[model samples]
Target: MRNILVVNGSVSGDASVSRALVEVAVQRLLGINPDASVTHRDLSHGAVPHLTPATVAGVRAVANTDHELSTQALSDELIAELQAADVVVIGAPMHNFSIPSSLRAWFDHVLRRRVTFSYSEAGPKGLLTSKRRHMRSFDPPW
Candidate 1:
């Protein structure tokens, strides 16, 4: 892939095994494609805010207030990043059998209705036609 997006969702930061795994995967990918570029999004540092009514309004393109407008801008930016990337690597350490809240928040921001997907007569249709590779590091809680 020419453009790679590495999203780290582990709150454990440097101590996260999932993050380490992602690093290895990224390095391997880079080794194969020496000219490829990589962009990182660390969600543990409050980079992605949890969804609120304002954020919902923004993602829906009904933003009116300043807060909603700002949230919408963020959502747009995140979606743009996703659209530009050819590969997406996600580090997700199991948090009570689910992904971290920050990662969930990121999903909430990027998975915009009619932007990433749409309803069809048969079923849901995906609008992002570009081929994407997703590598997620899932650590099960024992």
Candidate 2:
């Protein structure tokens, strides 16, 4: 892959096992493709905000107010990031049997209805077809 997007969703910071796994995976990928460029998104520090009415409106492309418009722009930016990536690596540790809130919020921002996916007569089809996704979920005993 030419462009790799790495997402860290661990709240435990440097102590996260999932993050370590992602690091190893990234290093292996880099060994395979020495010329590939990597981008990182750390979700532990609130880089992506929780879903709100304004953000929802933005994702739906019906933004009106200034807050909604701004959120829409942010969503567009995230979508562009996803679109530009050749491979996506996600480090997500299982918390309460689900993903972290920040990662969920990241999904809320990028997963647009007509933009990223669409419903067809058969089933839902993702618009991003060629990108590869690698995810590591380390479920530690809590």
Candidate 3:
């Protein structure tokens, strides 16, 4: 069975065009793979904590010593979702000509050292092998 991770980054909730597109994409995936399981991470509703010094410390602790820090649980959960997913879909709307802060926070949580990536002799390498699909919606100027 395929495991799909859908990340909703639009703060407009149900009114977001990006989210509506995501719904359509998810439905199509479900139609194609009836046994597929989906995990939804709604960033607008429950935004990931911003990467502060404490959060950085937590990431370092996990990478270096495998120790649990204050934000360890949340980070672990996010990493686990990424690791378990066979496909990942991100819905991000262009806000101020860039991605939303909530989506950036989500990326901060997932892009951890020794979790989503690691430093090799050449450079940093992505650990995730899952297929990723990104959907962006923009409002036209009136």
**Model 3, TM vs. native:** 0.82
CA lDDT scores, all candidates in order: 0.83, 0.85, 0.77
Model 2, 1-142: lDDT tens per residue? Answer: 8988988889997688888888877887899999999999889989789877656798777899888888889889889889999988888789889998889999988899888999999998899988764455534434
lDDT of 1 at 131: 59
Writing each residue's lDDT as its tens digit, candidate 1 over 30-123 gives 9999899999988988978987765579877789999889888988999998999888888878898999889999988888778988889989
- Compare the candidates by TM-score and give the number of the best one: 2
Query: TM per model?
Result: 0.89, 0.90, 0.82
Any idea how many clashes model 3 has? 0
Q: lDDT winner between 1 and 2, please give it.
A: 2
Which has the better TM-score: candidate 1, or candidate 2? 2
TM-score of candidate 2 to 2 decimals: 0.90
